[model samples]
Target: RALAQRQARDERADAARLYGRIATAHTYAGRYGEAQRGWRAAAAGHRKNGDVAAAARALSELARVQEYAGRPEESLRTCQEAVEWAKRADDIRLQAALQLRLADTLEHLDDPEAARLHRAAAERILEEEPGDRDPEPEHGANACEIRSAPAEG
Candidate 1:
């Protein structure tokens, strides 16, 4: 956290990335409040720095943190916002992943129909990929794998 704050004084984008790493650590430690604050700052900083894709990724993780904190309503809203950012970033894979995540949150909220729709949308997105497109890397199958930072010693 101190490192991220220090970086914030000079490099907004780098600070956002550092905050994201701290947020991931907080999430693993079950420190939901700190995790939420870190992720929100990461998302905001990324957005302000004109890194929409990074902001989308941060928002996606924030939604997961919200869900883990038992705030499904907030999770749903955050997921929706993440989806929009992903779209703006022109990252189809991330958008599809966010949709699937939104589906999971909907299911947790007892909205199975909505969940099903989101699942179908995600499937459709994947299916719509052109045959010539490059295949996703082995780890790319999981959205969380896309942005998760390596654990620091």
Candidate 2:
């Protein structure tokens, strides 16, 4: 939560990590609106720091929280933005994961054909990686750890 205070003071990098922590906690607690807001803040912080990949990840989280909040159309747009950010980062594995996420959002949006195409694209990208597939981000600490930390009063 110290990070949040720092964020409030206009410290972007610390704000980004703290927001991620807060969002993860909110998600666990089923507070989707708060989670979405936290993640959106994190995305802004990441973008300010010139970390497009991190911004993409935050947007992906935001999309999921939006879905949980029963806002499928909003989630779909956020997922699409995440895909664009992943593409800009040139991380094929990340791009593929984002494409799969986009497919899920498209399915929720009632666009089966678009969802299928996105799924196929992700599959093709994975196939190009040989044995490498399903790469996840390497955050040092787990979500529970982040949640356990005391929030600043």
Candidate 3:
């Protein structure tokens, strides 16, 4: 945290990345409040630094934290905002991944029809852009795998 603050005083972009890492650590530690705050700061800092992709990713993580905190409605809103940011970033893979996440959130909210629509949208995105693969894994797995997993019977 101190290092992130120090970096914030010098390099806003780097500090935003540090803040993201801190937030991820907090998430793994089960500290949802700290994670939420850190992710919000990271997203804002990244946006202020003109790193829309990073900001979108931060928002995505924030949405996940909200979901983990059992606030699916808030998660849905945050996920929607993240999808918009991903669109502005022109990152097809991130957009698709976020759509899948939205689908999952929707399912949790008892909106199966909306979830199916989002899942189909994500599939279309992946099909339309065969060459676009995310360089980094999202949520500890391949986005495609997340999208394509078969339902448990």
Candidate 4:
């Protein structure tokens, strides 16, 4: 893995892609922190390489890992950043992906309004997207309905 990373660094575009692969592997290995760090590096590299869409894609994956690690708030922040990056890149596909991520995170955080907003955004974007698309598959389905946030204890 170290050798792969070194070789990846020799080429900027390849380095960004390798960092994403390494980060995914780290996530599979149950190293959330390491994966998050690697994803951050990948995001930075993508942004520097003028691939804002790719950067947003990395951030979306990082947010997914964060959500799996039980950090909903952090995941939301990361997803929001990814959404902004995607919008800046004018990549509708990436924007829809990020919206779904944010929606899933918000759903877990008990922010039904925000989650619904993102869900609608995702649906709208997916409607215009070419080819077959399923938003639910891309974004995890919610365990609870989006009625409203329950009262705090």
Candidate 5:
């Protein structure tokens, strides 16, 4: 009761995130229908809030759930829509990410040729993105420590 009241009071935008969280929980709980509905709701809410990234992310989640539910064709379509939303957001990294995902889903949908094309597109973007950008060195390294006993006199 108290928890429900608190949930009801959550900000609408934040509630979108909550819906995605609940979707994940429901999937883990083996509640396929509930998980999917939650993900769809999250996508809708984030879209309404003008958060293209969040909306695409939720659609991607929904795609994954549809795959888990044994609807690979639907998953493929859903993943393609996710990629579309990602493109609308103009996020290159997200584009590469979702292109890869949608490509894989197409593979499962028995469209290997389309999958290859999508994969090539993603690879082209990733390859072209770094041509002018300088690469950064790795941030951390493994250091070795040595202990020496006092030298014998």
Candidate 6:
């Protein structure tokens, strides 16, 4: 929290990272509202820093928070925005992950067919990559719903 305050004051890229951590902590602590706010801040910071990928990631996290808060429609919209950003950033992996998240949101919104389509799209992306397989079959045919831990820098 203190790191977030310091980073916010400095208005640096590190601020976005701190906000992401803070949001994750909030989510783990069951503070959905705070988590949403933190994710929004992180997204804004990433955008300001010209880091489209990070902004999309923050938006993805925001969508998850919205889903947790029972706002499937909002979550779906956020996921769409994240997808767009990922495409703009040319990050195929992130785009595929966001597509899966969108699929989950669509399922929550009672659009099973659309959800299935998204799962298929994500699967296709993974299949096109060499040596990539469904790491967790328990998560279903795509394992698209699995939340991967953030990569360490």
Output the number of the TM-score-best candidate.
Answer: 1
**lDDT per residue (tens digit) for residues 1-153 in model 1:** 566466757877788888899999999999999999999999998999999999999999999898888888998999899999999998877887888888888888889999899989987987785554446533554444332222234
Q: Deviation in angstroms for 80 in model 5?
A: 1.3
Candidate 2: RMSD to truth: 7.5
RMSD of 3: 4.3
By TM-score, highest first, what's the ranking?
1, 3, 6, 2, 5, 4
TM-score of each: 0.84, 0.79, 0.83, 0.77, 0.78, 0.80
RMSD of each: 5.4, 7.5, 4.3, 6.3, 13.0, 6.5
- lDDT for each of the candidates? 0.83, 0.78, 0.83, 0.77, 0.75, 0.81
lDDT of 3 by residue, 1-153 (tens): 675576757888888888888998999999999999999999998999999988988998998888888788998999899899989998777888889989988988889999999999987986787665555546434342223222334
Stretches of model 3 off by over 4 angstroms after superposition: 1-5, 130-153
lDDT of 4: 0.77
Which ranges of candidate 6 are over 4 A from the true structure? 8-11, 128-153
**Candidate 3 vs candidate 4, TM-score winner:** 3
Better of 2 and 5 by TM-score: 2
The deviation in Å at residue 130 for candidate 1 is 3.3
Error of 6 at 51 (Å): 0.9
lDDT for model 3 comes to 0.83
- Write candidate 6's Cα lDDT for 1-153 as tens digits: 677577758957888888889999999898999999999999998999999988999999998888887777888898899899888887767778887888777877779899899999987876776665556534545333334233234
